[model samples]
Target: MIVFFHHLTLATTTTNPSYLTPSTARCNSTAVTSCTTTTSIIARCQSYEVSWNNHCYYLDGLGGNCTTGYSLATNAVLGCIATQFASKTYRSTISNNCCVWTADTYECYGFNNNCNTAGPFSAGPVWSGAGCLSVQQRYSAQLTFCGSN
Candidate 1:
């Protein structure tokens, strides 16, 4: 399952009328189709939105960004993401998608077991742009972890 808090603007280059509407958008982590089609999610609002048992947290809204350090093929926390969230109120410890331990995102990852596990572990690096795709692409780190230490 995919869960995100920040609002997003879909496709920005299209002249189609649907682009003008506000809703959940779909963009290429690279191609970026249109911003008009882009919907809204979040802006300055940051919080730990937990799903399932508590694994899925919407890592957006924070002043900073997030990313996974571990890999699915092998467990390793080598990457870096924004630990500073706009909220920075909680200490979140992020794990990779595989459930391996990862660096701290200033908050804890309260995820449930499989089946109920929050999916699409986004290793945020949420960027500054006109829209979601305009910024960075949040891919599943295949990493997973609990909240902070």
Candidate 2:
């Protein structure tokens, strides 16, 4: 099932017309043509968003321009975020499409059980351009201990 959020466009670029449009229908990870088409329409992040502490944030500028106290967000960071997200929420492995976005953007991911039909879906909205490839930490781990005599 697909869900549509309130549609609003802060800005649009000729490079990508799908900006802020209904994107839940794009990037069907199960279909190669669908995913390719989606990717082609959307542009990469101009600001290059990065996943930090399970949250997505855009860098100050392009070409790895990071501010003080902030380092570049690499694939490793995104992968770590994906791994953490998967383990905490579903306690399962991540899909191959996990952390697929190569730019700063918003991302929508599905649970491991339904990554195909659903997805860690991207190729949609770019952060500074056109796409929906962002992440937020919705779960946390708590440890419980038992004492034995």
Q: Which ten residues in a row have the lowest lDDT in candidate 2?
A: 140-149
Whole-model lDDT for model 1 versus the true structure? 0.27
User: How good is model 2 by TM-score?
Assistant: 0.20
| Per-residue alpha-carbon lDDT of candidate 1 for residues 107-143, written as tens digits (9 for 90 to 100) | 1122232211233333322322112221222234422
lDDT tens digits, residues 17-90, model 2? 23212233433334222112233232232222323332343311122233343333332233324332331221
Top of the candidates by TM-score: 2
Worst 10 residues of 1 by lDDT: 70-79
RMSD for each of the candidates: 18.4, 19.8
On a 0 to 100 scale, what is the lDDT of residue 145 in model 2? 8
Q: How accurate is candidate 2 locally (lDDT)?
A: 0.28
Q: lDDT of all the models against the reference?
A: 0.27, 0.28
